[model samples]
Target: MTFRSFIARTRVLLGATALVLAGLPTAASADVVFQSVANPTDVTKFTSPWCSSCSNQYRIFDQFTLGSASSVTGFSVALYSLAPYWGSGLNFSIWTANGNVPGTELFSQSLGNADFTTTTLTGTALMATTDKVSGLNLDAGTYYVSFYNTNLAVWGYTGGGGNLLQQGNTYHTGTSADFILTNNVPEPASIALVGLALVGLGVARRRKA
Candidate 1:
């Protein structure tokens, strides 16, 4: 029946809401774990003729470093071709860095042409592909991602590309490529609830004044 009593009841309701939120499970969201900045001036070209001697052993590798442990779930790359047709598929791998070179293979998979969602950057000239990976657990260290195109279609990379993450290089060995890695990040519901409770308290204080 009283104005102060009403505010007190509202505060109680807000506190109950916060308690309920705290009991709920935290939600997981995806975010970029590593990123490469595109540079026009440093595009590395991968052509069959130039790498005729390159067998199954040769794959383009771009370097990255993690400051802390991570759980990687997916990756994507920008690709293009000067020729009329895009490549068939790409073999992707993550490797441990041996000094400045790719050392041990950690994970690898093949993504077919159909897996790539075709998007045009400049009238079918540039495109990108996205694929989910089984969450790969990695410790804080240097690493490399390698790409092997099944066909002559170029894997876009700039030797001069900027390291947006500030932990790695843009390209390696001219034919090596660059890509973005993604990981699941846990977001606590309790944090949001606490924020809401603080806002409600601020409003109540203003009203009382």
Candidate 2:
């Protein structure tokens, strides 16, 4: 085939490929949006009731920021329970930031066996539980999150983490503990696919010449 005809066919092929790629949605992936490490000085407390009639119930809150719009897929938290209670129930709440504190409540729900998976450290009672959430969309801004076990032991947290201004008790602290928030992020490789297509076209054109 003549070089001109070969180039024309290549352009058409590239155009079709570009259109297909553009129409495809970005694949979602797990991303850690925020992670608070364990602090030694912070007070730890039992944030939830062990039973339905239990009067000793508590809650805890932590702060995090998002640089861009994101959808939360799930979260993982550290627990200091006597034994591993995988697939146990837990509660979560999200709120707008109010000057270093939680303001208006945005989302709250109870997660059950269907929503969670658990892992326990070897030779230790330390357990970490991850729960799947029905995507919570939020704009770029600061926010606060609070959570507790529905019927389990204490939540590992840093009561105020040496920040005296933070209010509340160990059962209901103004600060948070060791935890991580996961977001559904678009894959960066999607952009590279376009570049790869262009490179392939260039390679073919050189061969024809």
lDDT of 1 at 33: 77
lDDT of 1 by residue, 1-209 (tens): 57678778778877877787768777656687776644422333322222211343344566788878887876666555444235566677788878766778999887776766655544334545564567588899889776566343334443423221112322324433446677865567756766776868876786877
The total number of steric clashes, by the backbone 3 Å criterion, in model 1 comes to 1
lDDT, residue 154, candidate 2? 34
- The top-ranked prediction according to TM-score is 1
Off by over 4 Å in 2: 1-29, 38-57, 83-87, 122-131, 153-175, 185-209
Model 1 — TM-score against the truth?
Answer: 0.55
Clashing pairs in 2: none
The residue pairs in collision within model 1 are: 60-176
- What's the lDDT for candidate 2? 0.58
lDDT of 2 at 70: 79
lDDT of 2 by residue, 91-183 (tens): 777888888666899998778756666565333234445536775888899887766553444344444331111224432344345567787
